[model samples]
Target: MGKATGFLEFDRLSEQNIPPHERVKNYKEFVLHLTDEEAKVQGARCMDCGIPFCNNGCPVNNIIPDWNDLVYRQNWEEAIKVLHSTNNFPEFTGRICPAPCEAACTLNINSDAVGIKSIEHAIIDKAWELGLVKPQVADKKTGKKIAIVGSGPAGLAAAQQLARAGHDVDLMEKNDRIGGLLRYGIPDFKMEKSHIDRRMEQMAAEGVNFLTNHNVGENIHPDDLIKDYDAVILSGGAEWPRDLPVPGRELDGVHFAMDFLPSQNKVVAGDKLSEQILATDKHVVVIGGGDTGSDCVGTSNRHGAKSVTQFELMPQPPEKENKSMVWPYWPLKLRTSSSHEEGCDRDWSVATKELIGDNGVVKELVASRVEWKDGKMAEIPNSEFRIKADLVLLAMGFVSPQQSILEKFGVDKDARGNVKADTEGKKAYFTSRDKVFAAGDMRRGQSLVVWAIREGRQCAHAVDEYLMGSTSLPR
Candidate 1:
């Protein structure tokens, strides 16, 4: 450790965010990254806690204490080296990851965590500014051709790793653009597309081929990739949004979060859609209280919705967690997102009963408060309510990967519909079909971006080992 007493001397500090009112006016990143000195002080707060549970908390197992020490010493160069040793994309995780690592922080047991994510944001941003992030051209070619379907974090990570290992990597994307959810599903205000763009450039320089508008099982055939490529890796994320099966689900003006989110992202990227869904002056009701629902709230506010309200079926969690009961693990607690702060009426323990429409367009919705007992839910009698809603957005989260591609590939699927594949032992990541593998949301169901990167890197190593009988790629 750089300073044994540093943790005692310094307090935890995090990145500052712009006021919600001002930030919601436009779809742009509002988080102010930590300055160099602020980051150093935050880094100094990492205790000499020998275990570093933050590593286990992080999906990629980042070397936290070492980098914290390096950053506290102002050794920026080596800090990034330690960072890149485990996680391939720090900037993405730094910005959007929920930072489970912080919850597992030793300091968090008593006080605030060390602001590790902000330090990572600083390190990666500084590395790029100093031109420390450069392409690693392979010194030798293994003559193996690999096709990675879906250009999300998982696919991108695997492609970069395999290409750097001297293999020919072809990244296939169904959309016109490269990034999957990063390019479409996520709102621009949360994270700009330029981050994904820069990483794509780095991967391309390392000999990975980017093939956009290539929808396997549709415009492109899964058999084609299987026949031409030496190995096939599936990273296509879960795209199946869980639907509300209540009455009037087919009414007009009701849509899925994926449909609503991607349209705005396309508009931001200069695409013109004649039939774009808009919340302008509409009474918007977002269903489900997850990140997607919050995103709907933010976007609706940006579009000048007359009113915004969000509903959650589950009971509201406590604002604070009992650390003693759930230390070093992700605890269940109430989380208020920036969008909620922007302006939203939030109701918990409520579930939608039905959507009502006039002239075939949804005009209102009925809901009822629920009570849970013995692991089962029962509606509270006479607790029914109604809310005006000119537009309804379903953000109840994804159920599984879209079955089309998986069906076309004849890949075995788990009970939840994700492509079935194991993560341990030799031939790990191998799908039921020979010469095929699966990872990320496609295999594990919907998850965070950090976990996707970890799965991608590990899957890449598995593929490399299967092909060349050895692998140097990190797990």
Candidate 2:
């Protein structure tokens, strides 16, 4: 350990964010990474605990303590090396991921956890600035080609790993751009698109062929990929959003979170949409209290909405979790995102009953208070209320992967509607269809970007082993 007693000496310090008023004016990143000294101090807060639960807490199982010690010692190059050893894109995870690692920190039991995410942000940004991040071109070619569908975190990670393992990887995306959700689903205010573009450049230099606007199930038949490529990997994320099938669901103003979010992102990326959904001068109601809903709030604020309100069906969680009961694990606590800090009327335990509309456009939302009793939701009597809502965005998470792609490939589905695949044994990641594999949300359903990256890396190892009869890539 770089500093044995440093945890006791230093308090946790986090990165600063731009004021909501100032940041909401433009669709640009506002969260500033910690400075070198601040990051070093934060890193020093990492305890010399024998068992590092932070590693287990992190979806990618990053070597947290190693990098923490390196950052504390001001070893910038080594810090990034340790970071990249597990996470393919620290820039992505550092910016958007809710740090489960911090929750599992030994210091968190009694005190503020180390600012691990901020330190990671600093390390990766410094690495890029110092030219430490570069193409890892393979010395030898395996002559094996893999077609990876979907260019999200999962696809990107898998492509990067397989390419480094000397395989020709064709990373395909149905969208007009490279990054699937990262390019569209995520607002630029949280994580700018330049980070994804930078990695795309690095990946191209590393011999990954990027094919954009390539819809395999539609334009390109699924059989072609299996026939032409040595292996086919389905890294496509879960795109089927959960819908609220209440009255007036057919209203023109009601839209899925994906339908509403992508257009704003496209506009931010300098694309012109003839009929893009905007919250300008309208009363916006965003249903669901997850990250997607928060994103809607941010984007609505940016769109100059007359008012923005967020609704969560579940009861509100405690502002602070009981650390004694949930220590070393992700605790249920109220999380206020930067978007929520901007401006939003947030309510919990409210369920929408109907979307009242004038003509074909939504005008108001009728909802009622709810209470949980015996694990069942029970509506309170005579608690119904109506609120003005010119637009409604449903962000109640995703239910399953798009069945079209799965059907096209003829892969077996689990009970949850995701591609049926195991993470262990010889058939790890292998789908029902021969030479076809599934990973990320396609296999495991809706999850974090870090989890997607982890699944992608492991799936790459599985595919590499299947092809070469052995694999050096870490799972």
Candidate 3:
């Protein structure tokens, strides 16, 4: 609601990316954020929708209109306040989230949607530049202790909220670093690790205790945490990657996406590995067409792979979605990542048949074109083919949280092997065990970072109310 006629006055403007040729040379952020004027113009494009379906579309329920108005008025300070009121880490989402908010915008019915994500990115970048982001230490210490296992987005968000609520919170992680998959699975080009480091600094100032390399049920006993803390929240993300179990699956060149991704991250952090699974001068075939698959393609290209190809089992979706049919909801459509721009041959309706190799080393992959009718998939007759693939990365998404952690806690799991917990009612976020709760990908299975942040914030409120019978933390 910037100008009432602002939508007509200004057109949607998106953030620009560095050229693919130049960006592929380095593992750094290539997307250039909008200037203050560009961001203000973009923010002004938001129409004063009576319902504001953008809010409904956002998983964290961000106040889009309020912030858009604020940004248009040049209230950078107030814009960050509103943005952070709901999102604990706007910087994370601003960089990587697929903005569903824009899709639900009223202007999207015909014209381009407001650049909400770009404005968000601008607001946060300015906030950091002006040093507006600071730790909010609790005025009083409640003395009650809480243990949160995992260091992913959900765990980090919950720990921050609980710490600010006058509670002593212990954030534990098995990895040597804080961000679970964010630190490893994601490429540095999407978001620099410094963002996580800054949050860690602020959280430390807020009295959140972090324990790294504390793998529960192994080095650390789960019973100790349950016994010592007044409450426990599990936010360990889904880590068990969905793997292809076919002939020659045990080949040396066939590796999970997690294995390939984490190694690259470690190298970027200056960890010299004697042996690393490299894609240099080798043809690669990634099995999956999701974000993770795109990441594999990008990483392989940076490594100077001879060729890159990606396969999706389902048929290709349309480049544009029917807004009339899927308005205010996530729609199926073709998505090409920045990595795809670097260079990748993508195919749909193709399924990997088998890994062909010699001496237990993957050299090629056999596949078949598939056709889907109703809900069934069938291989097309006489459509078998083969492609050279020295490296194979299975990026078919995760199936469940690592069973070892969930099993050790003895928490009940839903049919999908996720931690059994309701999102509503009096028992919200409460697990089968007393004083035990779960959130994030561990509870909801694999999902977007924005969704994980929402679950974390809500779960924190639920925990706070359960302990104190009242809470001020926003859900």
Task: State model 2's lDDT.
Answer: 0.95
* Weakest lDDT window of 10 consecutive positions for candidate 2: 11-20
Ranking by TM-score: 2, 3, 1
- In terms of TM-score, how similar is model 2 to the real structure? 0.99
Which pairs, if any, clash in model 1? none
Q: Show how many residue pairs clash in every candidate, following the order shown.
A: 0, 0, 0
Candidate 2 lDDT over residue span 356-457, tens digit each: 889899999999999999889999999999999999999999999999989999999999899999999999999999999999999999999999999999
lDDT string for model 3 (1-475, tens) is 7688999988778789999999988899998999998888888888887999999889999999999999889899999999999999999999999999988888898888889999999999999999999999999999899999998999999999999999999999999999988898889989889999999999999999999999987999888999999999999989898989888898989998889988988899889999888899999999999999999999999999999999999899999999899987888999989999999999999989899899889999999999999989999999999999899999999999988888899999999899999999999999999999999999999999999999999999999999999999999
| Candidate No. with top lDDT | 2
How much lDDT does each candidate structure score? 0.93, 0.95, 0.93
Candidate 3, residue 62: Cα displacement in angstroms equals 0.5
Off by over 4 Å in 3: none
Instruction: Pick the winner on lDDT between candidates 1 and 2.
Output: 2
| Model 2 Cα shift for residue 429 (angstroms) | 0.8
